[model samples]
Target: MAIRNMTVATRSLDADMTVDEFKEWLRRFDTDRDGRISREELRRAMRAIRARFTGWRSRQGISYADADGDGYIDDSEVDGLIEFAQKNLGLKIVAY
Candidate 1:
């Protein structure tokens, strides 16, 4: 799936949630509510999104978005994760 544009992809999200809403959607994956999603948390979230990822979270999915190399996804890295999802998994983030 080719993500041609952010606007189109944003609209493709469930209920056409805005970018901020998409961020909030991802926030739910932060099980600890510490404003960050750990590697494991991200893996489970991807599964919830119906993404078919293989291997462990630390090795595959996390590496794509963990820009800071901190082993966790902070607010700054959320966009990276979004982009990864769009480009690789074709996931449309939505506020639920």
Candidate 2:
């Protein structure tokens, strides 16, 4: 996927991303296709949004969203990640 054009495709994800849309976008970074998001994947996602301090933020995001202490954000923990993205990454997400 072209990371540079992702923002344009999603309108920078500032307009508002539905829960499904957010998950779809995030999944693009799951390089391993493990149906889970790791710190590195999260960092890449952060970079896609042009966020600063990606390393730190990715660590923090994993810490915040890894509810099961699995070191990865799985499906059930996605809500926490969504919250982290909205609050810390300045992304607007809407549940509809």
Q: How good is model 1 by TM-score?
A: 0.68
Q: Pick by lDDT: which candidate is best?
A: 2
Tell me the TM-score of model 2: 0.87
The local distance difference test score of model 1 is: 0.65
What does candidate 1's lDDT look like per residue over 1-96, in tens digits? 322334321334333444576676677678898988887777766666555553464356578888979888788887787777667766565434
Model 2 RMSD in angstroms: 4.4
Q: Which regions in candidate 2 have their CA more than 4 angstroms from the true location?
A: 1-13
Backbone clash tally (model 2): 0
Q: Which ten residues in a row have the lowest lDDT in candidate 1?
A: 1-10
TM-scores vs. true structure, each candidate: 0.68, 0.87
lDDT of 2 by residue, 1-96 (tens): 212334523457456667887888888899999999999999988887778999999999999999889899999999999999888888888877
**CA lDDT of every candidate:** 0.65, 0.84
